[model samples]
Target: MSFQQNLQSKLQGHLSQIDGRFANVKLLDQFETNTKLPRSYAVIGFVGFYLLLTFLNIGGIGQLLSNIAGFVIPGYLSLKALNTATKDDDEDLLIYWVVFAVLNIVEFWSKTILYWVPFYWLIKTGFLLYLSLPQFGGAKFIYYSFLKPVTDKHLFHESKPASKVN
Candidate 1:
């Protein structure tokens, strides 16, 4: 029932869960496989496309052009990640592509309609930014700060001492 005992109990439970999760697999084993050049190559791929787009002046192509480029950027990255066996890197890329593709399709088809407010573009931009930020690990930090303590306590209550048994 003491505070120290409660803390120890909680830590032990967490260690047990972590142990179970990684008992058969080493999460760090793949860390060494990521070489520098391949990583740089991925970056180069994005930069190349960006440079080409800048010179081609595709920005004037209107909504259809914007939609295609938006989807292509993430879509290309997603495929590249998969080809390289980068699961963690690909997760965000895949999600971004999906969102971009959907938005692109919707915008491309809805141009003729006039009911929607022009602020729809601003709203869409905000939603896209919100969705993409968490993939960079911001959400994990927020959740740990706000929910970890309460969750840790609920998932693991303090154990009674052997001497306390009747």
Candidate 2:
């Protein structure tokens, strides 16, 4: 097993990781047990509420919730990552932030038009969750496949001295 999976298994042996990125959903799982709730129902119902909000596009609240999901979890994780002595955790999350920065830059300019896109908040929230989740490696895949090539060619080149005209 990889270091992260191993570490997580050891640390969160009893908790479920469904509600959000940072916290465990064991409490919800435990509550469901006595109530005899279907596992899938609980999962779907929990997520569906947020998706319903996005689907309805209730003013800006749906978008706000989606954005909160994107930021609050990672912001907390970044702090936890900062306090840890292990270099591995820092390196893992660093890639996520890099991808987020690139996406945010693009979003900044494109957001005015993005509202016209169908289910924009739902799509954005799903993408952000996929990027932030370590098990998925969405961030790493995009970084290596797309961003790395461009940055390696342009950003890295800028750090080198220019050729002399003489």
lDDT by candidate, in order shown? 0.51, 0.77
Cα misplacement distance, residue 52 of candidate 2 (Å): 1.4
Give the Å shift of residue 16 in candidate 2.
9.0
Write candidate 1's Cα lDDT for 1-166 as tens digits: 9999999999767656654554454332343245423233344465566445533445443333334445554556556777885577666665455555555676678875324554343344344444445345432443455445666788566557844775
Highest-scoring model, lDDT:
2
How does model 1 score by TM-score?
A: 0.31
Per-residue lDDT of model 2, residues 12-113, tens digit only: 543344434323557666756777853445666767897888767788776787777778878888899999998886876888889988888898888874
Worst lDDT run of 10 residues, candidate 1, spans 31-40
The superposed Cα distance between candidate 2 and the true structure at residue 119, in angstroms, equals 0.5
